[model samples]
Target: MNKKNVTKEKKTRNVIIIKTNRKKRNPTRTYETVSSNHYEMTVAGEAMHVTIERRKGIVNSSLRLSTKGLLVRVPLDLTEKEVQDLFKNYKDWIQSKWQDLLEKKKRQKNNKGMIYYRGKPYQIKVLIEDTIEDKKERIHIDEEAQQLHLQLQSTEKSQWREILKEELRKKGKEAILQRIPELNKGYDYDYNKVTIKDQKTRWGSCSGRKNLNFSWRLILMPPTVMDYVIVHELCHLGEMNHSPMFWYRVSVMMPQYERYRQILREEGTYMARIIDEVELLE
Candidate 1:
């Protein structure tokens, strides 16, 4: 028997650090401190928050941007002047990214938008009505009208959004459960378990234990695309990695798998954005 030795690869940390000697500048510049560990600076007329995080493994300084604010990771050995200078050098890049994030947030605030289900666009309709049921129920999908109706007693947008996600997850779970068995028939592989998850970046993952994890957002994709993802993960049951044999197994089940893969590569980010915006409504 030939035994295969597989070594797990460590993922590289995404840390950006500037470690170059800086030219001497005006020493009289004043900086506004937000807290003991945070510094506030005005760049291009926009307020940028700088946070300093000290850690053991990090050898250099790094800058990261998010919706909340900017984070700077620096080694404990560096002086405050060095850190401030580093921030000044990357001020332009920081300002650009901050502006971009603000624009994205503005766009995401408009949650009254269309969502795709099974390759069809449906308008989201929030219906507020008093009902006997304490829990939010009576979710309806009008296929003929191409609208997803969320019947909720609470007029709060956040509450309605959560209810809608729960309803969608339920629907997604049902669809995955119904489809997996049909696809597994006649196949030699015996899957141990199947689970639906509210994943952000991944569509599906297969464990060595024969357990399959699928994203609930699969319901938002076209039927063909969803089938491709299912088959792709199922193929992993036979071959754990994306070898040529794995592709062969996937192609046997889905001949046009490449087409669907291309579609996902192009539009997957947009779909993720839609899901995130809906769930993150304030």
Candidate 2:
């Protein structure tokens, strides 16, 4: 290749796009589906649409609920009537779970000051310190109490929101730094920098320079889901694209990765909305 072509190839190889962050929020059950079998079901007196999908590797039928609608994934051999029968068998259980989801949405809508850490929500309490003699600021995280107390001096003028944001960044960076090494063990994954950014749309990204970059928002997810993102970017160090070979390597490192992947696909947008006050999404 000529010098210009060589540089272009080099750029193409190294300039990988950031990992996709699905931030589309769908509070209602309206969604576009190609499946002609789409139909509506009433659970908890709320109408939601349902769609059935068949895949080759699926051995048993599975069901999940999301804002878009209910999805039933079944093995290729499973007929539509069989799926209906499965739902019939689990009717009561499905209604209970769907009711719980609606209740959670009610809480989220009314929540004023809350933060999510490691897949759990903690209430954020900003208060003027009543106990400090010198009037210093401190953050007391009561995990057991499920609260973050931001005690600021009477004269302190910093935005408590910024303070809390910085605190989250520190915690996120610490967690990512700590977990990467633990997950990287037993593997020959090679990479350069591990940057934690306030990425609005991506859980993680890997560059052609072999640098690994992750969003601090990932700290909001469950640890297993966070680890999946880590292993995903690390896998790119060996294979640069989302080819089958790359997934095989990721599977070798984290066998249950797909379970977390599904969680991300379903709840990622909701998670992104959690502490969205300071960093508003467009």
Candidate 3:
């Protein structure tokens, strides 16, 4: 999730990668165009010289033909005419997708960052207290309220933050380990290491040797959901490819896996976004 968040004043550009597959009836297929600026347009390999703009929310989205394909950027809340005009302007370069681009937009719209942890919306707040849970312990989180109360047990604030991070890592790792035995019940997995990282790309990854790495954000998700992710990765030790056989193995271990996978895909975006955009400093 090494996603760069564009600033308010920054002028962002939308770049799409047009893939031309000679096998198809329409050999050229417009993949997708993404932007921090909200707008929708497709890019074609044939059209690489024109630009168009659409209104998305408060910003105007305009698309132009680029070396990559089509680039669009526009102002906020543009009309249908503006969007169609851009497509018309670059019709040749804007090939249609097999699945409508609108469907992808729908997926994005349905995805939310609002995490339902411990049966409620997580509201993270930070406060300072002198109470000592541990000598160097600096952060105590309320799962219900999603609040992080910082009790600076060390003279150095940086030390306190580091200690807090360590605590989170330790807790998250333990949580994952505790479920390993149950998840791998009849099966045997040489569960090696469980480390917490601010990973940018994936939620969790497992090595051939059964070593597991998970994002600290997994701690923010529901216990069952988090366990599902851990189980899914651990299963990778036995089967690497995401084939039906591999999924069957995962299902045998975690019956509610399908549900969890759906939740993770829909909600993981917001979780990654939180880790990227918000720093809970105590």
**Candidate 3: 10-residue stretch with minimal lDDT:** 1-10
lDDT of 3 by residue, 68-142 (tens): 435455543434564556456445434543123334445445434332332234433434455655546554557
Task: Give me the runs in candidate 1 sitting further than 4 Å from their true place.
Answer: 1-112, 132-137, 155-157, 278-282
Which residue pairs in model 1 clash with each other? 16-62, 17-61
Which lDDT tens digits does candidate 1 get at residues 1-282? 001111221211223445433322436543332333777777656676767776433344567776677787665555777677766766677777778766756655554566667666677777777663755455677999888777776655557666767777887888888888888773667898898999856999999999999988888888887888888888899999999999999988888898998777655555655855654222
Our model 3 lands, by Cα RMSD against the true structure, at 12.7
Off by over 4 Å in 2: 1-43, 47-104, 130-137, 155-158, 278-282
RMSD per prediction, one decimal? 11.4, 13.7, 12.7
Q: On a 0 to 100 scale, what is the lDDT of residue 47 in model 1?
A: 73
The best candidate in terms of TM-score: 2
Candidate 2 similarity to native, TM-score: 0.61
lDDT, model 2: 0.69
Which pairs clash in the backbone of model 2?
Answer: 14-208
lDDT of 3 at 51: 41
In candidate 1 the C-alpha lDDT for residue 11 amounts to: 16
Error of 2 at 43 (Å): 4.7
